[model samples]
Target chain A: MEIVVCIKQVPDVPTVRMDRERMTIIREGVESVINPLDYIALEAALELRQKAGGHVCIITMGPVQSEVALREALAVGADQAILLTDPDFAGADTLATSHVLARAIQKIEPFPDLILCGMQTTDSDTGHVGPQIAEELGLPQVCGVNEIHREGKFLVVKRLSDGFVDTVKVTLPTLLTVTKGLCPVRDLPLGALEAAFSTKDVLEWNMTDLDLKKEEVGFAGSATQVRRLRTPPPRGSGDIIEGPPDVLVGHLLRRLEALSILDEEDEKK
Target chain B: MRLEPTMKQAVIRRSVRKFSERRLIAAAVEMDKTEQFPWDIAEEMAGLQYFGLEIPATYGGAGLDSVSTAIVIEEISKANAAMGLCISVHNGVAASPVYLFGNAEQHRRFLNPLAQGKKIGTFCLTEPNAGSDASALETNAIRDGGDYILNGNKVFVTNGGISGINLIFAKTRADGKDLGFSVFIVESEREGLEKGPIEDLMGMRGNPVCPLSLRDCRIPLENRLGDEGGGLKIALSTLGGGRLGIAAQALGIAQASLDASIKYAKERRQFGKAICDFGAIQDLLAEVGTRIEASRLLTHRACDLREKGKKYTMESAMAKVYASEIAVEATRVGVQIHGGYGYTKAYPIERFYRDAKVCEIYEGTSEIQRVVIARELLKG
Candidate 1:
């Protein structure tokens, strides 16, 4: 069994500014960290591999600095790391990023039996890369997965849906986008970290290595482009209405009726 | 001539900061209130290899440099000074001597498990009679055929009760004429060893500081560290590095005080304006920030010297004195900035105030550090 985990590195600050003209984050002095939710996905993959006896591989697409994230994954027990970096891969949207990742997965020996990803990235927050990768790879995909376990050749996953959870069984060679509820990430051991930083085996690949055309990757292959970026306006402070319990309920109901949030006739019906 | 940390050091700082914020910060206040040793957190930190941050990889350590070790201590101390004290003692004074002076066999037997965090280690040089005048220790070890019969009482030992390995210093006589000191690696599970109850201290309450009593404790002669009469040299050398660890801890505490003060000053209102707008408060903040930065530079300079195998005795002493003093002053200002809230347990500044005092007293007192610096200067 071979498991693959997709991760990304993002600015570590709570709020980031974007360059509207370039449609990119102004990352001059901001520190980068592994996308926190991806740690949960990587933890899930590691746990699965630990039980089922398989190797865990981590893949990320970004600039050279993304290797820091890969080395961190290696420190936490990932067996292999592939860094997909190229000038052609720059400015790629989720669709092109997923395409390149799918191609890289195919290039791995003894192709992955399971692919795991964080449900969403903190930077992009689109939650589109995982499903898109699954579509590109033609594999069954499970998103918002909070729990996963291997049952022989199939995967039993618990997915969080609106108001309820759905337990689904998918056959082997499936993709899962895990939520933070999947599992808590363990601390990286010091010895493993020392080895990871010193080793030179982290494989770096480019578009040429993946056998992809320039037009089929990066910005040229992206289907959507960001036109503008701006911070949302600050929310107004709330008003507090003080009255007797019955009067307060009545006032709230009257306000809701005034705003057309509640249909009085429908309520009567 | 860059004073800032290198990229690798920055990475270490970031990683340690994340670890401390996630694991230590929440428990720090509660641990201080309850005065409980954080055994679970210690186990977790060991898994992270914080217990062996500077020891080599061959001994199950992080194989990091002295600067990296200092960075780890500083980050951890910023969150919880008590845990920081435990780590500083374990890595700096206790385990380092073995790695530095012990033979390969001793390293395999003692340093490996201690560095791996499989067993906690501590230094036992201070006794009832000896505090700063370490050579005046009353503990004695008598050679008795293939073993040494040891009898001693150690006080204020960090990680005392929980430690599995203890590096103890005792007076010995290879020849009847001369009174000399020797160091021994004594296992806690041995017979005739008694662990006293943990001390109720003013600060750094989470550290399990306790007294240890040994009566006729039998340690194999093979457990001796370095040659006979070389114990003082070993102790002094180990403490040179240990002083840097304490300096880092002090720097961390000082930084924490400044950080807390800044946040509180900005949020607190007085005279219909934020207190931070006042010139008095700004002066205090500016002074604290400058002193903390200066302390950090001194500590880092000592760490750099140690990394390059240069003699850092004077440098470490200077760093320890200045940084610990800065910690006390910064935390005091932190409390003053919080006004009445600082006196109460409602704020963390009170705890920082308590914790900062010990940095001046332990490792070496401010006066002792001054003496060391003076001695170094006069020698030239």
Candidate 2:
């Protein structure tokens, strides 16, 4: 049960500011933290390793400063931390980011038996990287996993999809994109923090180390470009209807139909 | 010359803040109202080496540096000052002296459990007659063959109710002559050791501060900490370090109050605008914010000095006095910013106000801190 957990360091959401002029996020001077959901994934991986007896290795692809996130994960009980940092890895979209992650995973000796990631990152919120990494590695993946159980080389997981609870059992060497309830992230112990921050043990991988070309890793490999960035329009105030529960339900259905969020047939059902 | 917190210290602050916010904040209120120690939370904290913040890892301690240790206490105090007081006193005054003075056998026997958090530790010095004048302690440890017969009553023993190990300061009497003060590692379960009822307090009510009495308590000669007459030296040195922990605690309380004030000012509307929009409210916020920031710098400077093994007695005294004073002031301003709402328990500002006052009073009063600073300045 060698597990690989992918993590990203993003600007703390509350402190984030948009660079209106440059049409991008203002990252300088802002505090960075591991994505909250990624913490859940890491927590899940640790639990699995605890139950199955395997090493949990955490990896992240970002600038040198992103080592903070890796150190944090190490402090939280990750067995190993690999920092994937390179100037050539800048401006990577979900596609290129997953490619680099997949390549790094392939380079791991004996190859990881399981891969894990958060369902989405707070900064990008694309929910694409996990599935893309699975596709690139040709591994089966389950997204939005909320519960996990291990049984004899198979993992049974539960997730919510289209308002339906789906319990899927997958064989070994699979990937999972965990959601909030996968496990609770315990606070990192203070004793481990000092060594984690000071230790030079974090393995660093660059373009040359991963056998990756510059054009296929960074901005050049990105398939999507932001033509323009704008804040979403403020929502208008909604009508406050005073009615009984039954009447409120009827009114809600009618409004949904009017907004084309639901069709007349679905409303009838 | 660098003023900014190092990356490690910054992460420590963030990590402790998250743990405090998510866990300690809610427990603080409940503990305050109930006046009961949360042993469960204590156990949780022990697992993270909160009790052994400066103890070496070889002895089951966290082994953090002085600055990082202070940061931890500060963040914990921010969420719950009572619990903060527990850790600060346990680590700074009690466990620290044992590590600094105790020999190998003592470290293996006493420091191990204290660092492991398996046994809560306390520094029992203040008695009925010995408040500011520590030498006035009437507690006597007389030489009686291989054992020392100790008779004294220690009052206002912080963490007394839950402490398993108590560092008792007593006057050593041999051949009917006083041999100055000496410290003894007195286990709470010893015969003649009795714990008094918990005191009803204004702030930090969750801490079980009580009186401890040793009625003809007998202990082996090995129980004496350091030399037979080295208690005062250990006490002075330990308290100097202890003041830094108190300063950090004060800074935490002050920071918490400022945060509450800022949030409340922005939300509470008066005269058709949020109170934050008013110039008077802004002045209060700005003043408290600046003071809290200054308090942090002063506290961190003392921590830095201590960490680097430099002379920080005066610096720690200054930090303790300034930070504690500003904590009281910040909480006052916090309550004022909240107006009438701050007067009630509806907001935590009132709790912060109560918790901040004790920071000035404990470890050493603001006046005592000033005295220490003056004594250092006048040294030839």
Candidate 3:
């Protein structure tokens, strides 16, 4: 089985500063890193490849700088990396991005038996790319997957839904959007990085390479447009009531009653 | 062109940072308290090629440049100084000499295992009589048929108890006259080689700094590194690079000290505001931060010269002395910033304080570094 992992390079900061006027992230002075959840997806792909005896290929849609993330993935034991970079591929929304990725995956040699992706990206947080790509490829997909394994010819997936875990079995040629709880991220070996840069080839694909048309990718193909963006307001602090236990209880009850959080009839009963 | 770490080097730094944050930093206090060698962490680092930073990839090493090697040491030392010391001694002195001076067969035997982390290595140069004065070492190696019998006690051997390959230097007599020195690769499993108990130290307790006694230990003729009486040259060259490693380690300790102080200052309140608001605390922070950046630049300059195959003896010596002294001072200020809590075992600042002092004394003392710098200047 051949596994393909879709990765994204996100800003390496807790809170990203956004350019509200431009409706985009303020990339200046911000360092880029592999998306946190994508590391879990890559780890999952690597584990499965280790057991099944196949190649783990990582694909990412970003600029030339995003190749660092792909090389990092290679350092952690990915067999190959394909970078989708082109001026036309910029400003793509989730639907356009998934369409481009699906075309790129089809261009990979030997094809991919399994496709893996993070549930959502930290920058966008749309959580639509994985399912959209699955739809684009005409393949089965599992979203928000916390655990996954191979059972015979099918894949077993476990995901939490409404506070209960749902386990489902799906056939091959499937896409999985993994969560952070899947597995621990492995360290990148120094020798592996040296070997990757010196020996491994990180193939680059453009619009022509993937046979993508101008109307199907990039800003021209994007269906959603952001008119404005802003950071959320800071949360307000809670009120603390302090006194003796009886007095505190009385104050809490009176406050709750004043706020109408408690029913007077129920309190009397 | 840039003195800062390259993109690839930055990746390496981040990887090490992640590993150290999760593994070494959490276990540092317990390891210090128990005085136990962190074999597991060593194994993990070896798997990550931390032990083989400067070694060539063909020889089961990472094949990174000298600057990258220093970065690895600095990052690791920031988390745990004792582990840093072990790696410095192993890579800088022990494995490096064998790779530089050893024959093909010797490299295949000794350097391979050491680089692979299957076996730990250490340099045995300091004797009871020879601390800074290496020529005064009393250990003697006698030439026997097909073997050389080594009889000496080496003191303060880093990674001594756990090491498998020991690069030992001893005085040799040739033609009825005492020649300079000879280096030998003595395996720890050899007969008559006894490892002393771990030293009870004020700092860097996690390192197995111990004594080794070699009584009639017979090493094969091929085990000798370089030529007869060529040990001094080998020792000098190995230590020239080793000083940079120590400097980087010191820089790491200093940076950690400043980090701890800054963290504590922000959270610790006094006089109705955080202590960080005070002018005195801010002064300490600024001075330490500047010193650390200067030390890093000096250390990296030495590394750059070494990588370019230029003479960096004086540069490395200057860096070592400056960085080590700053480390001691910075940790002292770190402890002062924490006030009473820094003195207790509850905080890591106390551990940093204890670990900082030894950086000035090891590899080469600050006095010795100053002397080396002066000697190089005089020669020019």
Best prediction by TM-score? 3
Query: What does candidate 2's lDDT look like per residue over B194-274, in tens digits?
Result: 999999999999999999999999999989999999999999899988999999999999999988888988888889999
Query: Candidates' interface RMSDs, in order?
Result: 1.9, 0.8, 1.1
Query: How close to the true structure is residue B346 of candidate 3, measured as C-alpha lDDT?
Result: 88
Every candidate's DockQ is 0.48, 0.74, 0.68
TM-scores for all predictions? 0.92, 0.94, 0.95
lDDT of 2 by residue, A41-100 (tens): 999888988898989999999998888898889888898999898998887888999999
Q: Which candidate comes out best when scored by DockQ?
A: 2
TM-score of chain B of 1: 0.98
**CAPRI quality of model 3:** medium
Candidate 1 vs candidate 2: the TM-score winner is 2
Q: Write the per-residue lDDT of candidate 3 for residues B1-380, one digit (tens) a residue.
A: 57767767778788888889899997788779999987888898998888778889888899888888898899899999999888888999988899999999999999999888888999999999998999898999888777888899999999998999999999986556787799999999989789998899999899888999999988889999999889999998999889998998998899888998999999999889999999999999999899999999999999999999999999999999999999999999999999999989888988988999988898889999999989988995
- 2 or 3, which is superior by lDDT? 2
Task: Go through the candidates in order and give the C-alpha RMSD of each one to the true structure.
Answer: 2.7, 3.0, 2.2
**To one decimal, what is the Cα RMSD in angstroms of model 2 from the true structure?**
3.0
Using TM-score as the measure, name the better of candidate 1 and candidate 3: 3
Cα error, residue A67 of model 1, in Å, equals: 1.1
